[model samples]
Target: MDHQGVPSDALDPASPDPAQWPVGRLLSSAARRVERDWNAHLATWDLNHASHAVLAHLLRSPMSQRELATASSVTEQTMSRVLTRMERSGYVTRAPHDDDRRRHVITITDAGRSAFFVASDRELAASMVTRGLTPEQAEQLRRLLVVVAGERGPEDDPDLSAGSAG
Candidate 1:
């Protein structure tokens, strides 16, 4: 309600609890909360979200910085910083491509694979987001959030990304 005793969707910045926030604010803050909690969990393995992402990609196959940046939907400059950090942590290595010395391929090290295996625990991650919800409720929440996010990329629809033979 506003000063005039009318309903309002606007958020009160002074509020300490998110339950008092607007829907949009609630959603955005909740996402940040989940990310923060997840990062804290990943810290045990000495890996954060961005570094873990690079490791996951390298686990499949070594890729040039350009390829990784594209796959991760980030810029080469950003990917370079991430690679540098991961390299110093002994999670990944960057070496010049044989065919093209201008391009450096990034590969996950043994330590990276081990950390990824442990840090990428599905149940642990899921619980961070779905805690207190029943399995069915969590599944419903997942579907609702996806729908509310509106846009769907090719990966969201397997039939579209992977052609189905008629």
Candidate 2:
């Protein structure tokens, strides 16, 4: 049976041979729901999920444009376009790095921080649309997600380990 309590032939346990795994299918369906809700919520700000994610990363630390691109897993050109749009919208500012004149450092502006906080709250609320889970359950889910993403703890990233925000 599918998550909605429907007996989906495509998801029938007996029919599934080598093509699909139940866990993978469940994760995919959940991801689709998250994507749909996230995009809808972001529509109010005229931002996409990627842009919001980039801003969230910047909220944690001011980073060089290249570092931001790497952290966000976006190409340099794409990150540049996103940054340009954000700058025009007054959500972020780019200044020359103090140590390296050639590199541009990206920082979230006050407006950006406010927007990110609002978006994060909206996303958290939307996350409850599927099913309400307790805080413990949410933490467990995060751990599972980290494992799925192949990410190590903060210790793995020296940048994250450092107390400095920039």
Top candidate, metric TM-score: 1
Note each model's CA RMSD in angstroms: 7.4, 9.9
Question: What is candidate 2's TM-score against the reference?
Answer: 0.65
lDDT of 2 by residue, 1-166 (tens): 7864656665644444534446676687678887887778876776778889888898888988888889989899999999998898888899999988999999999988888787778546536543578766776676567656876755564544463343
On lDDT, the candidate that comes out on top is 1
Kindly give the stretch of ten consecutive residues in candidate 2 with the minimal lDDT sum.
157-166
Query: How big is the positional error of residue 85 in model 1, measured in Å on the Cα after superposition?
Result: 1.2
The digit string of per-residue lDDT tens for model 1 on 1-166 reads 8753547755565589876676678888889999899999989987888888888888899999999999998999999898888898899988889998888888889999999998999999999999999998898778667756767754675544464332
Worst 10 residues of 1 by lDDT: 157-166
RMSD, candidate 2, Å: 9.9
